[model samples]
Target: MENNLLNLRMTSKMLSRQAKRCQKEENKELEKLKKAISAGGTEEARIYASNAIRKKSERLNITKMASRVDAVASRVQTALTMQQVVRSMGITVVSMEKAAQSMNLEQISAVMDKFEQQFEDLDVQTGYMEGAIGGTTALDMPQDEVDMLIQRTADQDGLELNAELANIQAPQYLPDEAS
Candidate 1:
């Protein structure tokens, strides 16, 4: 199971790389499309557009395959862990059975009494209630407090992401914005 998990992870990584390469090729195809459009080559632009669309679908398919492989790997790992736990529990049960055979009836009765008394002495519910008495969760926040937090963080971010750079990619193909 461990080996199977490892193989699944490796396959997922390989597929992810394949997806990356597909995206790289798709970008190149899009660039060719822009150039073809700029040169007024209608047939060439159509071909490049078709190729770019195919590459995008290929990338998406590869990504989906990788996700499925990862999910399989996770299940295999969980099963392997459960198998180990069950094996350990079986050994523990055997040990307990052997020890039980050595204990006398009165000894077992005394142990059971002590266990019951200890359980009765522990106030688990009260301890938990005390811990949670003053606890506050996000859902407990008042509307006014939520509004204050939003206003406090309402300032514009200093970071700049110039998305216009994508349009200006083919400078010769696109007219200047100022013009």
Candidate 2:
């Protein structure tokens, strides 16, 4: 996935350069055609300038189309990649292809952004709750209250959790045997 993103980044950079070059050439041609039309008189330069303008416009349109295509493709690819990542990790995420077909790119992008933010929030909340649960600070709660909270947490889905802790033992750190 990272490789795909890197490839996309490189391709976009190349495409941007190409598009810029095309635009510059078109602008230069248009300027020359304008000067020719102004200085050489309409009867002599009209057809030449008209043809030049049409060709330049076509070139510019093609450049813009290419840019739009590249951008859409990149976004769709990223969304598909995100879906794959979720599936591989046994996590359920919104489908990118479906979103691409149904929603505008901006909407899909917004949803993806929100999804990422939510995940970050969940991570921070999980860490804080875990710390509170396992911390040395004693809670004034009754045993039943702690038990209910533990059970509630255990019931949640898609949390990448293992067996519930019966006791908060000090976590072990193993030295790398390969070292």
Candidate 3:
């Protein structure tokens, strides 16, 4: 489980780096677009616009891939946890069966008498252990975070296009004032 999660994480990191490169290239293209627009070079602006759009698309795709990988890693963790629970339950059932077969009324009574205190002590001990060793690994990139990542990419896709285009209005019949 850990190995699978680690591999997915590494893949995600690589995708992230690729996405960052895409973003840098997109930013460069956008900057060039601004220069082209300023210089009244419509052809250059068109090329830069295409390149920027392409790069942004790549970044969005890479982000989505990373998010999916993270989701898989989370699910893998969940499955492993569920497996442990099932194993524990099986062991508990077996123990109960053995206890039922061997224990007399007096033995049962005595265990019942101590069960509450023992359970409480176990809880306290487990709590301290958890506090000492617990980590985000057990709850990494939950569904909500994956959803947020997807939502952000969706919002960013629209916002990037809208905001950049909005800022670049056509010359409003005035000469140099448009710049």
Best by lDDT: 3
Question: How well is each residue in 76-143 modelled by candidate 2, as lDDT tens digits?
Answer: 55455456545633432444455677878876786677668667765665565455433422343566
The C-alpha stretches of model 2 lying farther than 4 A from their native spots are: 1-7, 41-44, 80-179
Q: Rank the candidates by lDDT, best first.
A: 3, 1, 2
TM-score of each: 0.58, 0.36, 0.58
lDDT of 3: 0.69
lDDT of 3 by residue, 1-179 (tens): 78997897799789889999999999999999999999999999999999999999999988877777766766666666556656655665665566678977765565555555455655665565444323323344465445445445555576443553343433324332356
Task: Output the lDDT of residue 90, model 1.
Answer: 64
Higher-TM-score candidate of 1 and 2: 1
lDDT of 1 at 163: 58
- Cα displacement (Å) at residue 80, model 2: 5.9
Tens digit of lDDT per residue, candidate 1, span 10-48?
997999899999999999999999999999999999999
lDDT of every predicted structure (CA atoms): 0.67, 0.57, 0.69
Checking candidate 3 for backbone clashes, the offending pairs are none
On TM-score, the stronger of 2 and 3 is: 3
For candidate 2, the clash count comes to 0
How far residue 166's Cα lies from its native spot in candidate 3, in Å, is 13
Model 1, CA-based lDDT: 0.67
